[model samples]
Target: MTDSQRTALIDHDVWNGGLFGGADGRWYAADQTRDVIEPATGERLTNIGVARAADVARAAKAAAAAQPAWAALAPRERAAVLRRAAAALERNLEDAARYIARETGGILAKAQLEVAEAATQLHIAAALPLQPQGLLLPSTAGRTSYARRVAHGVVGVISPFNFPLILSMRSVAPALAMGNAVVLKPDPQTPVSGGFLIARAFEEAGLPPGVLQVVPGDADAGAAVVEAPEVRMIAFTGSTAAGRKVGELAGRLLKKVSLELGGKNTLIVLEDADLDVAASNAAFGAFFHQGQICMATGRIVAHRKIAAELTRRLIDKAQTLPVGDPASGTVAIGPLINERQLRGVDAIVRASIEAGAVLEAGGTFERLFYKPTVLSNVQPGMRAFDEEIFGPVAVITPFDSDDEAVELANRTEYGLACAVIGASVARASAIGERLKCGLLHINGQTIADECVNPFGGRGDSGNGGSMGGPADPDEYTQWQWVTVKSTAERTPF
Candidate 1:
C-alpha cells in the first residue's frame, strides 16, 4: 500500500499488536496502543503502536531474508541513496528540527544541531562506501592475501528518548551503508514524527523497501526485537538494567550485540581552572535538557581553593536558565521527558538531602520544567551521588588534591565520559589519565558531536558501542576474506 513517495512495509494483519498508523496509503495499527505527551506540558500528542512479540519476529525474519540481496549491492550504490537522503534532509531542515524539538522537548538550537548532524551523518556514511579495509597476509606472499569488511546482515537498533533523531540515525545510517537491513525501534514517546519522516525521506531518496523498518512500541516490542534469531546483531542504548536483558537475549540468539547504557559522569575542576569558564561549562552540562542526558555532569569534584567561587557562580547561572517551550528560541532549557523521569529525579535528590547533603539552589522546582538543582556536601553513599540521576540536578563536592578527585570521580560503576577543567594542559592531561571513562574531555565539556568523537565506554560505562565518530561505522560491520589462484599455479593441489 506504499506510494512512490515513501517506502512502507507491514506485518501480517492477523498480527495486529497494540499500535497502528497509515501513511502513503498503507495502514498499520496495533490492537493496543499508548498515547504520547509533551514532557514540558502534559498534553497528549498522539498514540504509538505497542508491538506484539509476533511483530518483532516478523520484522526480524524480513530483515534476515532481505539481507543477501542488499549485501550484494555495490557499496557505492548504497552510498548514492544515502547521498540522496542527506540531500532530502538538507531541503527540509526546519521541519525536521521542529519535529525533534516538539517530540523530545529538545531546545530549538540543540534540535537543529541534531538535524544538521543527521544530514552530515548521512553524507559521512555515504562517503564511507569504499572504505572496507583489506590487509595483505604474510601467509600468501605471491598473491594479495587480505580480508574485506562486509555486512553482518540484519542489525536491530533500539534508541532512547533523549536523542531520538540522532541516535536512531546513528544506528540506521551505518547499517544501511554497509548493506545491512535494520530493525529500528525508537522510544515510544517520540516515535511517530522525526523517525517516521526519516524513513519517508530516505525512501523518496531512492532507498528500497525493507531496508529501514520502524516498529513503534514499548518494552515488549524491544524484547521481541532482541530475541529474534533472524536478527544478526543488536545495537541498543538505554538503561543498564535493560541492556543486561538485551545482552542476554542476543547471547541466546548467538548474535553480535553492542550496547551503550547508563552513565554517572564527573566534571573535574582543578584550582588552576578558569573559575568563570569552568562554572559556565558545569552549569550547562548539568542543566541542559533538564539534566536528562547520560553525559550530564551529575557529579563535580572542584579543587578546594576555587570550589566556593565556582559553586556560587554555577548556582547563579543555573537559576537563570530559561525553562519553557521547546520551539521558542529564547528558552535554553526544557522539561523532563515524562513524569516518571521527573519523579526519579526528585526521589534521588530528596534521598541525598535526607542523607546529609545540602540542597543549594532550585533543588526541586515544581513546574514541569524541573528547576536546575545544584547540591553540595554530597558523598558516595547516596543514590543521588552514586547512581545515574538523569535530571538537571548536580552534586558538587570539593577535593584538596588531584588524587582524591580522580579517585572519587572513578568510583562510579558507570564510566561513559568525564571532563577536566583547568587553566593549564598538564592538569587536564593528568586528570584525564587517572579518570576511568570511555571518553574524557580536557579544558571544556559538552555532551557529544558526531563528527569529532565516536563514543562508547569502559567498565560499566558502555559496551564499546560507537554510535558515531572515530570507530568508523564503515568498519564497525562484520568482514570476510577471499583468495584466488590461477589454474596454472594450482598444479600441486
Candidate 2:
C-alpha cells in the first residue's frame, strides 16, 4: 500500500488534532505536540498531543468514578460486550493493520498477526467473567465461609511501542473483564496503534464512557497514573531500567504491579542439532520485527562441534534477507523504529567488534534500515552478548561441553526466554530445565506468546507476577474472604 493510502485508512479528524481522551470520546489539544514519524521513510506521519499529569489525573478520576457501576454489571453482560469488541477488532483488522504498519514500521504480516493476537486476547477475556469467581471454604463452627475475587478499582496500563496492540490488549482486556477500569498510557511514538485503536474497539462495542481511557504521553503521564490514589494496580511492559522505577514507586504506594520487562535471552544449538533448522530458528528469533521484541534472542550458545556450520548458515540467512520499507510488501525486514534506535544498534555492533567479536555478516545500514548482523566468537563480557541490543543482531558464542553451554546461557542477568535445539528431545528438555528463563522452547524459536498461556519472566524480566490464563485473575483482582452465620452467637468477654 502507498503511504497516502495507509494514512487515509484511519479517521484523520480524530487523530489530526491532538490527544484522544477515551473517557469522553473527545480530542483534547495539548500545549506540546509530538510528531509521529514513520521510521522507514523518516517522514512525519501525524502529530499527537502530549498528555500531562493533569490530563492523566482527569482520566483516572473518570475511571474511578465509573468503576462501581461497571463492576456491578452481570458477568454475562460484560462477557457479551467483550465478545462484541473482539468481533469489531476482526471486522476492522485490515484498517488496524495498516495503521500499525504505518506507525510502527512493521510489515503487513506482522501487523495483521498483532491485530489477530489482540482479538484473541479479547476472546479470552470474555470467558474470564464466566469462570467461577468464588470457592467454598471449610469452617469449624458450622458457619459458611467462602473466598471470592474482586476487582481493583482502577488499573494503570503503560505499554511499549513494539507489538503495541497485543501488549496493550493483554492487560487492558483482562483488567476490564475482571471488572476494573483502565487508564492506558501508550508510548508516545505509537499512540494510535497502542492506545487509540483499542479505545475505539471498546467504544464501538458499547462500552460505557470512562470505563477505558487512553492517554498517550511521556514519563510524566506514566508517573501520574502510578501515583494516582484511585489507581490500585499498574501493568507495565518496557525496559528493565524503566520497570525498576515503576516497581519502586508502586511498591511505596502499596499498589499491585505486574511488570514484563527486558530479556537478554539465548538460543542453544547442541552438537547433534540440525544445522539448517537451528540456523533458521536463530534468524527468526533475532531478526523478526527488527529484533525490537523484549523476548528476542540476544545470544546464540552453540556446541563447538557444530558452531562453525551453524554460524555459516546464520550468516547466509542474515545476508540474504531483504531490508527496506515494509509498506512495499516485498522486504523481509523493515527499518528500525527510529534514528536513535538505529544508532544504538550500530554502537553495540561496533563495540562488540572492538571487544574481539567477529563480524561474520551485516553491520551496515542506510538510514534506519539496519541489515541483520551476526557476531561470532562473542564472550560473556562483550556488549552484544551482555546487553539487550534491541536490534537485528545475533551473537554466537561456542562452548565445548554441555556444562559450558548451560553456563554460557545462564551467565546473563536477564532471563525471560530460552530455546534449545537438539536431535534428542529428552536431552534438550533436560538442558532447558537447567536454564533459569521463564519461557522455554525445545526445538523451536524464542519469541512466542499466547492468550491462553501464562506469560512472564524471572529475575529482571518480571516481579513474580504473570499475565494470561489463571495468572490474569491474580494480577487483575484481589481475594476477599466472607463468612456467614445463620444465627447470632455471643462470645464470652
Candidate 3:
C-alpha cells in the first residue's frame, strides 16, 4: 500500500494496529490500552496498547528464539533487510513526520528533521554487515589466529519520548545489522511514532518474524525488559536518574548496557566571536524542540566583552520566534511533552529567577506551551544554570577569560556535548581540548551530528558507550579470538 493510504487509514481509525510483537510471529492487542494524548492540542491522538511484565517476557523469549536463525543468514542478506527498511521509512516520511509532531509536540521542521535523521541512520546501519568482520593475525608455526566479531544475541532497547524515532533506530538498526534480535520498549507517550511506525517499516521491508519486538510501556514494563533473562544487552536513552537505575540493574545482571542520558551542555562565545551568528545559533540550540534534547545548549558562557551584546540579541531573537501548535507551519517552538513537564519547566525557570537570574524575555506559558525564554546574569547556584531545564530556556553567564569559560563549562556534572564559538580556530580548538565532554563542536551549535560521528556522552551522561559510525557494531557485538592449529606445540615444564 502507498504511504498516504496507510497513514490515512491510521488517521481515520481504520488501521488500529496492536502493540505487542508476539512470540507467535504476529502483532497482538494487549490486555489493556491507554490513551495517547497529543501535546499540541491536549486531545486524545490514539489509544495504544500497554504491555505488562508478561508481555515483556514473551517479547524477550521470541527475540531469543529468532536470534540464531537471523545470525545464520548471510551478511549480505542481512544488510539487504536494513536497506529495505530504510526505503520503507523514506517512503512514509511525510506521514511519520506528522505523527512525530502530533505525539511529541515538536515543531514541523524538527519533526521532519527527525524523520530524515532516522532514514540516514538506517542507511548507515545497512552497511555494517558488509564491512570487514575480522582481522588476520600472525601466530606460531603451523597455526593461524584471527579475531572475529559476532552479535550479542538479544538486545533490549529502552528509548525516551524526545526524539523517539532517531534514538530507537540508533540502537535497533545497528543491532539488527549485526545479526541480533531486539526487544524495543519505547516511551509510552510517543507510541505511534516510536512503536507502531517502526514496526510497520520493518514489516513492510519483510524482516523475519520475531526479529524485532516493540513493547509500548511505562517504567515497570521497562524494568521488566531489562530484567528479561533472554536479553544480553540494553541500549537506553533517557534522564540521568533513570540511566542510573538502568545502569545499576544491568550491572548487577552482568549485561552490557549503553546509555545516552541527560546533559547540561554548554556553548561558549569568545570576545572575537560573531555576535549575530552566536545569538542565532544559541537561540536555535536552546529553543529547538522546546529544548528537550539531551544535547541542547542549556548554558551559554560568554566573554565579558561581547556578553551583553550576545545576550541582548538572544533575548530579542527568542521573543520573535513563534511558539504554538506544531501544525501551524510558521511556529518554531511548540508545547512540552505533557502538562507535568510544562509545570516542571515553569517551576525551574521561576526558581532560577528567584535565585537572581535576570529574566530577559519570554518567561510565561499557556497550558503546555512555554514561551522561548532567555535569562541573563545567571549565577552558578541558580536552578537554570545548574540543572537541565528541558524547556525553551537559555541562561547567559559572563566569563572574563578563556580559562574561566572552560572552567565554567566543566563545572557541571554532565560531560555530554559542548560548543565553542570564536574567531580563531586554533584558540577554539585549544579550548575545546580542555573541555570535558564526549562531543565537541567549534564554530557551531552544541547540538550537531552525522552518520559518521560516534555519538555518545561521558560522565553521568553515559557509561562510555557510543551508537554511530564503526563503534555502533562494536557496542552491539562481542569480539572473539579463534586459533586453528595443525599440531600441538611441545612445552617443557
Q: Estimate each model's TM-score.
A: 0.91, 0.97, 0.96
Give the top-scoring candidate (lDDT): 2
Give me the displacement of residue 357 in model 3, in angstroms: 1.0
Candidate lDDT (C-alpha), each: 0.76, 0.90, 0.88
The reply for model 3, stretches above 4 Å from the true place, is 1-17, 487-493
At residue 487, candidate 1 shows an lDDT of 37
Q: After superposition, how far is residue 395 of candidate 3 from its true place, in Å?
A: 0.3
Q: What is the C-alpha RMSD of each candidate to the true structure, in Å?
A: 4.0, 3.2, 2.0
After superposition, candidate 2 runs with Cα above 4 Å error: 1-9, 21-25
Instruction: Quickly count the clashes in candidate 2.
Output: 0
Clashing pairs in 2: none
Q: lDDT tens string, model 2, 1-493?
A: 2334333226656766476554565666777778889888878888877889998898899899888999999999999889978877887898889779888988889999999999999999999999999899999686999999999999999999998999999999999999999999999999989988887777667788888888899999999999999999999999999999999999999999999999999999999988888999999999999999999999999998888999999999998999988877788899898889999999999999999999999999998899999999999899999999999998999999888988999998888999999999999999999999989999998998877889999999989778998789888999999999988789996
Better candidate number, 1 or 3, judged by lDDT: 3
Which is superior by TM-score, 1 or 3? 3
TM-score, predicted candidate 3 vs. hidden true structure = 0.96
